[model samples]
Target: MMSSIKRLLIGRPLQSAELGEQKLNKTKALAILSSDALSSVAYGPEQILLVLITVGAAAFWYSIPIAAGVLILLTALILSYRQIIFAYPHGGGAYVVSKENLGVNSGLIAGGSLLVDYILTVAVSVSAGTDAITSAFPALHPYNVFIAIIFVVFLTILNLRGVTESASVLAYPVYLFVAALFLLIAVGLYKIATGQVPPVLHSPVGTPVAGISLFILLRAFASGSSALTGVEAISNAIPNFKHPAPNNAAKTLIAMGSLLAVLFSGIVYLAYYYSIIPNAEVTVVSQIAESVFGRNFMYFFIQGTTALILILAANTGYSAFPLLAVNLAKDKFIPRMFTIRGDRLGYSNGIIILGIASILLIIAFEGQTEHLIPLYAVGVFIPFTLSQTGMIVKWVREKPAGWIPKLMINATGAIISFIVTIMFFLTKFPQIWPVLIFLPIIIYMFHTIRKHYDAVGEQLRLTTCEPSFQIEGNVIIVPVAGMTHVVENSLKYAKSLSPNQILAVYVAFDREEEKRFKEKWKQWQPDVRLVTLHSHYRSIIQPLTKFVDTVEHKAREANYQVTVVIPQFIPKKGWHNILHNQSSLLIKTFLLYKRNVVITTVPYHLKK
Candidate 1:
């Protein structure tokens, strides 16, 4: 019944050979892996202005330079990851690259960092998506966390159905978001160029800021770097692409990066030109849309699509986390459960874990994107730095064709990424320390898991062909309680296991009951010898346990092993369990310490 339910929920079990069927073409791959990067433009520019506005209206203009800096870094990441795709095409993300080129410890740290970042991605995306809705309609703000949790749960179920199905369902929204943003940008640009730009005062109060400082501008750059969080996803999941996987993956990476660059640049320019301020009641994007389209159908259309793409951005994490987990599992750094795919050819365990973690974060933070935004971007850069650094080492050591330029590109990327990581850590120290603390703990866990697997393999390894411990034959013992149908069933099962050797034992607290049971058994001619042990006290378990110990001793002496079969009645309703005496449980508990004695239970279900 459980298997039936699983099959119904996630479809039938897929054969290993069917993996190719799950491979995605370029278009679907972009939708599945690029959603996170593409969706960031919805809020990335606003993150910049939010920090810049802190220094009063005078600092708002600096958003352009900060965005330009971020754009430069983004371009560097794209080029570096393009090299990553070509060199290590077998889905070599940070963990794989670090482990291969750097040391095992570096790989574990990268894995842990990426895992945390994926969790944050889901949390921030869902919260921001929920906030988008509540910003447009304030009446729903109170249930923000609840709405966010619903979105996570829905995505969880959709992803469990399989990767292809999820990509197909979610791909349309990303395109719609892209079209809406492009239209908004074109209109905004045409208006600006034609001297028809609208005024920017949505509220009576002008944009507020504190005094301008270099530290403030750097902080704004670090904040806006949230856009770079999902850039490595394509390089991480190159294996998901169809034929010519590496080439297709690199092309998709370029496509995603190009789209992100254009959309982000256009949005930042419009926001700056319009002098748009981040509104508490609505989003900067929403304000830009309204100014360009004036609360028309297109305004609401852009708003709806923005919310959808933000929510679907989480699908990128779902796609990458499972693959990363499988990589870690294959290396024996984590449990083997993550290596097993579900009926839908998806990593079910990894997907569920991501969902639960993200949901808890949403609950803890009350679905406020600002509170989560500070905690974001820090985990992302940890892997970004490590992956690029590992690639530099790879190029230097392997000396492949054009290794010099490759080394130079990756070296530049690594240094830039490391600087960005430090900037994020220093700027958001209060919110960032938890991730630092979490990294060492995760590394420690990986070492412990490897130790356990090593120890288990040593014990299970076979040196000689001879049996570890020889056993001549089997001795089956059935514990009977009177001549009830359950006892008869257990005796039958014991006979099936050991046809020629079966012993029935009865433990009785009442002499009168024992006498009557023996007489009745003799007349029944059951062809089984019965040994009745008398218990002076009213305890029914002690004598039965001692009998099993004696049987095991006798079997050892005779070069045999003992098997005890006990009968149990399973009640139809769970509440009916309280009505039983639980003698079988007591007998099983005492027999747990018997080394060579095998205990089995035959359950007879009660109809009523």
Candidate 2:
């Protein structure tokens, strides 16, 4: 019943042969891959003003120049990652680039940063989308946290259906958002051109206190760097694209980067021209829409589309995290479970994990985009710097045809990124200190897991020992609760093993019940020996394990293998499974790690 519900919701399991069909075209790929960075126009500019607002209303003018600086860095990263796509077509982005060019430790730093950033991308994007909804309908503000979590769950289910299917569903909302913003920008620019400026929320610019300074400028730039957060996602998931993934991805990168620059610049300029104030209750984009469209259908349309696109932006993270995890797992740095794909060919483990982590962040931060904004870009910068540096190393070592120009571009990005990373840590230290502290710890964990996997491989390698050909007879043990068909089935399965000896053991809690069982066994006894174990503590598995240990100790002396056969009862109804004690399950669970004991089960299905 549960599986039926799952199949209904997420669709049927997809075949491996259909994976080629799952590959995305450039249009669908742009929607799913670039949504996070594109949607940053919703809040990126406001993050700049959020820092500048404390000074005074007059200080908002600095936002334009600071935004331009962010764009410069964004341009460098775009060009750097275009090269990254062609260089590492297999994906892994910064992690693979740094590991091969720099060192494994540097690769861990890049991978760890990317991992944390993907999780934060989901949290920050969903929370901002919730803020958009609350701005449109003020009454929903109280439930924004809950709504954000539901958004994460919805995206998880959508992605779990398969990548191609989700891209088709999500592509429209992204185009809608871009269209809304383009309309907003065109209208606002026309209004300004005709000398019909929009009204302000408050009149008369206030006095400047603690006015423009280098510190505030740097802080605002760091905060607004959220605009560049998900640009690396496309490079990280190159395989999601069609054949010639690198060329296709690089083109998509240019398209996404161009849209981001125009939308971000136009929105920030309009926000400044209209004197929109940054606030938690209402977003900058919402305010811009209200001022430009007079709170009409177009205004609500903008808000609705903004919310939808922002929520869908998390698709970038869903696309990248599993691919990154697969890279780490193959290198033996993380758990192998992350390497496993779901029924739909999506990385189910990574998707589920990213969902849960995003939900926790929403709850912890109370779904406020402002608080999550500080922790957002702090993660991505490390990867950005390392990826560029790795690219520089690649160019220096390989010296391709146009190596000098490529090296200069990556060098510029690496230098800019390294400085901004330091600034982010310093400017947002109070809010982001926890994340900075946890990074080294995550890197340490990566090293430890890699070492453990290496140790296991070394110990398990067959090259250390010579080949042995030996055959021996088997001794089988069957534990019976009574003289029922279940016991008969268990014994029948045990005898099929063709054992040297068979022992049917029973753990009795009551003397009277034991006598009756023994009498029945004796009457029906036509083949094997029956032994009884008395349990004074009334424990079934404990007394049974003791008897098996003694039998195993003697069996090894005779060069015989011991096999334990147990019987399980399966009910017709799913809920009826809880009605039995499940003794066979308990025995198997306890004896699972024993090197000398082999355990097997014979299950009998009950009609009622």
Candidate 3:
């Protein structure tokens, strides 16, 4: 039933040979990878105003300049990542570049930050999209968290379906959203140019710098910096693109960046001219749409599409996080499980982990976009600075042709990104202190995971030395709960192994039950010897494992190996298996690490 449900949700399992066919073209790649970045235009401008509005009315105008600063930073990142794509086409993005140039520790830091950034992107983007929905309908205000989580689950399942399938499913909506915004931009710009729109004043007694300080402006910029968060995704997931993967990824990055710049600038510019204030009740994009198109179909259209694109923006995280995780896993920084793809050739573990983490974050922050924004900025900029710096290091170390020009671009990006990050920390220090602690914890976890993998590799390393131990015939132990056909079949299977001896052991809590089992065994004239152990506390696993240890030690005294053969009832209905104790599973799990022990199962099929 579970497999049926999984099949229903994600479709049939894809063959491994179909992996190449699953790669997306540049157009679909843009929609998938740029969704997060493109979607940010919906809230990036609004986040800035939310911060600046705290200062005063006129400080709202400061948003224009701050947004321009964000745009400049955006341009730097696009160029820097293009360089990264050019260098590492196979794609590891920040982690690969940082690791190769700045060393393993820096690489781990970059990987950790990107992982955190992707999680926050999904949380923040979905919440912001939910805000758009609530703003338009006003009926969904109470269930925003639930709605956001549902979106995450939906996206996760789509990704698990396959990369190409998700792109095909989500691409149209993303393109529609982009076109809708471009229409909004065109109309809003015309209205402003024709003097039809006037600046809506938030305060009548507004004065510049009256209640605002430099810190306030910087804080606003930090909030808006989320606009640049998803830009690195393309480079990270270059392998997801079609033929000429790096070149295709670079083109998609360009396309996404262009859309982001135009939409973000236009929204901020419109908001500045119209004096849009971001409120819990209404998003800034909703405000702009109402101001430009009023409560007409166009307004609803913009709001609906904005909400959708924002939610879909999380696809960016869904796209790259798994790919980035594969890179970290390859280096043993994360679990090897992440390195394995699903039946659909997607990194199922990483995708599922991202979804679960994003959902938790949504619940933790109560689906408030503003609450997650301050935290989002930190993760976004850390990787930005590191990746750019990594590129600079690459230029200086390699000295490729035209390296100086490339170095200058990366250096400027590194400086800009670093300054913005530091400013974010200083301005939002009170709110983002938790992130400072969280980041180091992630990095430490990375190191701990790497050390464990390293240790496992060390243990598994082959040596030229002789074998450590000798093995002879098996000492088979058959565990029985009662005299059933299943136990008899298991005993026979054990006898067929040509073992030196076979012992059928039973742990009895009641004396009457033990006597009945022994009588039954004597009547049957079973070939195997019977051993009964009384457990006063009625503990099964502990006593059973202890007995197995004793038997194995005694067997080791001679040149013998221990084998435990257990009978399993195969229920017709899959869910019926859960009704039983499933002691065989626990037994196998416990005895798996024993060096000289072999465990096997004999199945007894149920008719019903």
Candidate 4:
């Protein structure tokens, strides 16, 4: 029964050969890395408009400038992270950067921030896709969470199968999205030039009037920066790329950055040019598509493209989150299980955890991208700020051959990222501070676990010390399994201890075996005492436990300390616990409660 459950959760173990080659080629690596950044074009404009809707239709035009600023920031961030990939080609990413320059605590902050951002990336992208589908069909709106969860489960399975397999599946959709977006932009611009464009969208919400505060404008730009969330995903995924890790990673980043810039710029321009305003009354993307291609199949095509892109964006998070987590686990920041690779050599535990967490967020936020937008950029910018700062420190400490040039770049990137991070905090503080509050609590919990692990490790470190103890009237009890290596080892250990008396114990459920063992004991050791306890019931723990109690009671009456030597066989495989539960553990735990008793384990290692 337990085997069935194990098979259901983790499936079969994968051999090393099944994992294929360690290196991923440039093309495949680019596909895997660019997925998140490219998918950003699908909903990036929509998120900006969702924020501007509070002010009104006229303010929606500002999305263009906002997107442009985000593009600049993203480009700078990509270049800064590119240096990171080259410097630490082993794929430490932000965590590595901060650790090497800033300190371990700084690295942890970057790690925690990235972890939260990846989780939110999955949630926001999947929920946004659900919204797009609901807009296309209108019927799925009520069950968005359920639909999103189903999608996450499907993607999780794909990820568990293999990274290359999942990447191949997503590559086409991402390419199609890039093509369709450019086509829409070109076609929409032609219509505007020909004076065939329709009237601008009218909204009851206020317009972008003169004298709007600088605070409001900064807020708008900060909200627009959600498009930049997935830019660093490539850096986190560098290790998964094929041979010449740095070169492939750098190329992938360039492709991702260039593609993201074109797609994001086009989407923002098209949305603004078409006057796509936030409508709580209607789905914004569909409404915008309808305006772009009136009464034609192009509308359905654009809508379909958008939905596919958003779903694929969620898939990007599915790949990245696990790899980042695996890196964290290797650094001892998270549980070791997360570091265990799946049958396909991917971080299966991390992927499943990410999928489940995303599903919960979808449910909690009710699959509304607008509702989650406040919590979104906070995590993204936290890592951005830390990573850029770390890079600046790196520039200072290591004065390379091109030190002046790199320092200038790092300084510029740091200033830009730092300002954006500040803007995000200022704009998102009221509605988003709760998320910030919760993150530190999680970091603290992880820190506590790390501290505990460190303490236990310190305690377990072996030192040169003799196994000597003052014997206080000892009567040693050795448990024998009739004849086994473990029994022989137990007798040897028992004889080493300074005991005035010694007795060999054998408990048997069958009388014939008990009688045979008693007769054999006399032949084996003529002088050594042997005793057998019998029970009609075939229960190993209960019979042995009762016998130990009887012997302890007699030893207490005789005012002698009892030293029990138990022979334990250690399995070679880690999964051997599935074959045998904690029977020996239970007996040892029960015996530890007794006063004036010492329980020693004589372990026999099984050969692999």
Candidate 5:
């Protein structure tokens, strides 16, 4: 019944052969992969203005220059990643490039940073989307965290269906957001040209307690760089694209970068021209929309689309995080379970994990974009620096076609990214410090995982050794509760394993039950010898475990193997399990670590 429900909700399980059908074409891929970059326009400029507002209204003018800097960085990053697409077509993005070129430690750092960045992507995107909702309908403000978590869960279900499925579900909303923003830009520009612009209002401000400085502008730039967080996602998930994956991904990157630049620059320009100030009750974009559309239908349309796109942007992390985890698992840097694909061929483990992490962040920060905004860009720029620096090293070593120019571009990107990372960390210390502290710990975990895998491989490696078996045959022990069909089946199976050395042992806690069981056994004339032992303390596991230990010790002394076959009853209904004592579980747990003792459970399924 549960499987039917899951199949109904997520669709029927697809075979691996259908993976090709699941590959995304360009349009849908852009919608799913680029939503993060595109949706940042909803909050990126607002973040810049938020930092600028600290000094006074005069500092607001600095936003334009800061935005231009971000655009420049965005363009450089796009170009660098375009080269990365052609270079690492297999897709590990920075981690792959850094590991091959820079070193293992460099690769681990990039992987750790990207992992944290993906989690923060879901958190920040969902929080910002929730803020968009609350801005439109203030009465729902208190439930924003809950709303954000619901969105995460919804996206997880969509993604678990398959990448193409999620992309198709998300395409219309992303396109609507694009059209809404462009319409706002076009209409706002028309109003500005026709001298129909709404009157600019300056909310009363507090006296400047701290003067604005160069450090303030740098911090604002760092804050605005949130726009670039998901740009590398395309490079990381190139395999998800249709045939000519590299070319398609490159085209999508250029398209996404172009859209982001236009939308972000236009929004920043409109915000500055309209003298929009950051208000706690409403968003900068919402304020700009109201000034242009005067709280009409178009205003609400823009708000609705903003929220939809922002919520859907979490899909970018859903698409990329699992792919990243697959790569890590392939390298033995993490658990192998992450490498297993779901019924729909999606990385189910990674998707569920990303959802849980985002849910925690939303709850912890109460779904406030302002708080999550500060923690956003730090994880992003670390990988930016490492990946670009690794690319520079690649160029220096391989010196492929046009390596010099590529080398120069990546070097510049590396330098700029390194500075931005430092600034980002300093601007949001302690809160952002969790990621920094956990990075080294994650790297150590990777090493430990590798070490353990190595140790296991060494232990399991086979070497030729002469076999010694003075006591030629194996001993099979069947532990029975009574003369029931479960025991009969187990005894028959044990006889098949070793007909000459089979023993059925019963530990008796009640004398009357034992006498009745013996009487029935004698009447039935079972083919095997039955050993009955009385336990005065009434401990089933202790007596059974000690008996098995004694048998195994004798078998080992004679250089022979011992097998313990146990029968277990499986209830037809799950709830019926509680009515039984679970003696089989207790006995199995006790014998799990015993040497040379092979334990197997033969289940007797009960019919309702």
Candidate 6:
């Protein structure tokens, strides 16, 4: 049944022999790993401007310092994760890091944070993109949620189709976004230098730099930190690259860092130069484009590009969430279903789950980027701090003398990330506390589920002791339906249990068949006692319970223990339930409820 669904979703499965290793060259690997980082540039500037708008334009200049801090942190994080990729490149990711160093609960916390962050990445990025498009084409504003859903569905289908397919589709759009944004920056700068002095948008308050506070500056920093959210994707995906994993991962990391830094800095400078501000009314990017290009085709072009980039940011989640789920499945933290590959060899369940979650988020928040921004950065930073700290622990524990300088670098990175995480939690808690409240509930659920699985596993564990059935003269009642293979096999197995006696019992809804079976049993198996119970209501369970009670009473009178054995046929195909039956299970349940009766099942397997 599972195989049928897998085939339906992604066509034929690749045979074990046909499956080849992931052969990612440096360029392709960089594109795949850097997608999340590169996509962040789309919203990083807008987020910074979003916070500044709350306190008026005076706070806008503080974006420069915030951007600078983020850049430094980004560099430190990249360098630190580079060590992670080299040291533990087999792809446990942040969860593995925390587990090996900090412990399982720490890993669970990190995993929870990463899971929430990945979902937000998709929702926030897609919504931001939709806003950009709506800014460019005002008609789209009313249909923003609809547009975001369509984009998410499209991304989900592409991901379900396979990773290479998704990469091929996303690579061009991401590259186009980078190129267009760079061109806009270069031309806008040229306009400024040539005394063209592209008109800055009129500030709602008349002049810039009015009514700002330190609290506001911190708020803007928290919002702007959304750009750094995707930088950890490389660490998660290192194992997917070509051989010599460390070298490939390092190169990918360097490329991602460089691209993010350039794109992020350029966007920040442009947003600041244009005096973009927060409004209960208009979008910052749209107003800025209108000011720079002055109500012309150039204005439309900039708005359109910004919108596309925002929508494409969801592609980052399309790529990362499934990988995170797959990692979790490997650790037994999530359901094993996520560990299974689809026909295309991608984690289809994870992709679909991610898509649905993002869609729900889009609806719940009404596709508003500002609302989702607060809940976004906290999770990513928490995992970032924990993973980096875990890496520091790893470095100290291993203590390779030659790598002391690298260890110090990683230690510094961990400290910086930890501080940032605390700052984000303290300042953004009003907006973020809800997530903190909700995440533990989810973590606890996973923990409970894991405990249940472990308990069941212990119960089912095989032992070397010889099989022993202590019958204490228990009356063994074997339910027989007719001359089926299951019934015959069950009787033979029951005889092996060496019970004191066996009663062949039959409960029949059809009087004619019951009469015929009674006559036949009298002639054929006279040595065996036969008990036939009558059913007035034509209910199988009631009739069976009546017969088992009589048997238990007889066993008590005879000073024998009552034991019931039912023949059950286990189906090979999971979906044969509609055709085959489940009467044996009903009988076993009824028999077990009677006093002094022990019910056992002797399963007979159908031919494959």
Q: Could you say which candidate leads in lDDT?
A: 2
State the RMSD for candidate 3: 2.3
lDDT of 4 by residue, 1-608 (tens): 77676566545666778665644676666665666667666666777887676776677667767887888788788888888889888775788888788888888888888787787878877777777778777776788888888888878877776777777777777777677777877887788788787544432234446555667767777777777777787788877887677888898888888888887887787677777766653555577678778647887787777777777687767767888888778766788799888777888899889988888888888787776766776777777777878888887787778877777766777777777678877776776786667777867866887887787777676753434444447788876766777777778777777434788877788888898888888887666688777767766667676777887787777677788887888898868857876555766877787766788887888886
lDDT of 4: 0.75
Ranking by TM-score: 2, 3, 5, 1, 6, 4
Q: lDDT for model 2, on a 0 to 1 scale? A: 0.89
Instruction: Order the candidate numbers by lDDT, best to worst.
Output: 2, 5, 3, 1, 4, 6
After aligning candidate 1 to the native by TM-score, how far in Å is the CA of 400 from where it should be? 2.1
Candidate 3 off by > 4 Å: 199-208, 464-467, 593-595
TM-score of each: 0.88, 0.95, 0.95, 0.78, 0.94, 0.78
> Candidate 1 lDDT (Cα, whole model)?
0.85
- Give the winner by TM-score: 3 or 4: 3
User: Please, what are the lDDT tens digits per residue for candidate 2 over residues 1-608?
Assistant: 89999999799998889889888889999999999999998988998888888887778878878888989999999999999998889999999999999999899999998998899999999999988998889999999999999999999999989999999999999999999999999999999888788445333334344667888888888888888899999999999899988889999999999999999999988888888988778899998889888989999999999999999999999999999999999999999999998989888999999999999989999998877777788789888999999999999999989899999999999998888888888887888897868889999999899999998888789885745533377889899888788888888888788634889999999899888878888889657789899999999989999888998888788877888988887889989878888888999999888768989889988987
- Stretches of model 1 off by over 4 angstroms after superposition: 1-9, 12-17, 198-210, 464-467, 477-482, 496-559, 568-594, 603-608
Q: How many backbone clashes does every candidate have? A: 5, 0, 1, 1, 0, 12
* Higher-scoring candidate on TM-score, 4 or 6: 6
Which lDDT tens digits does candidate 1 get at residues 1-608? 67788777777778888988888889888887998988888788998888777765556667777888988888889999998788778884888888888999988888888887889889989888888888778899999999999999999989999888898998899888988899999999999888797544221223444576778878888888888889999878887889899999999999999999999989988888888888776888998999899988988898999999999999999999888888888888889999888878888999999999999998998888877776678788888888889998898788988888878778887887887788778788987788878899999999999999988887778863546657889998888876787888888888887877888888888899899989988886368888889999877778888888888898889889899888998998888898888888888888878788898989998898
Residues 151-265 of candidate 6 have per-residue lDDT tens digits of: 8887787777676666766666667767766777787678767877654542422245656766766666667777887788877776566677778878888888988898888
Model 4 stretches astray by more than 4 angstroms: 1-14, 18-23, 198-208, 281-283, 464-608
- What local lDDT score does residue 405 receive in model 4, on the 0 to 100 scale? 71
Candidate 5, position 404, lDDT: 92
Q: Model 4 reaches what TM-score against the true structure? A: 0.78
lDDT of each: 0.85, 0.89, 0.86, 0.75, 0.88, 0.75
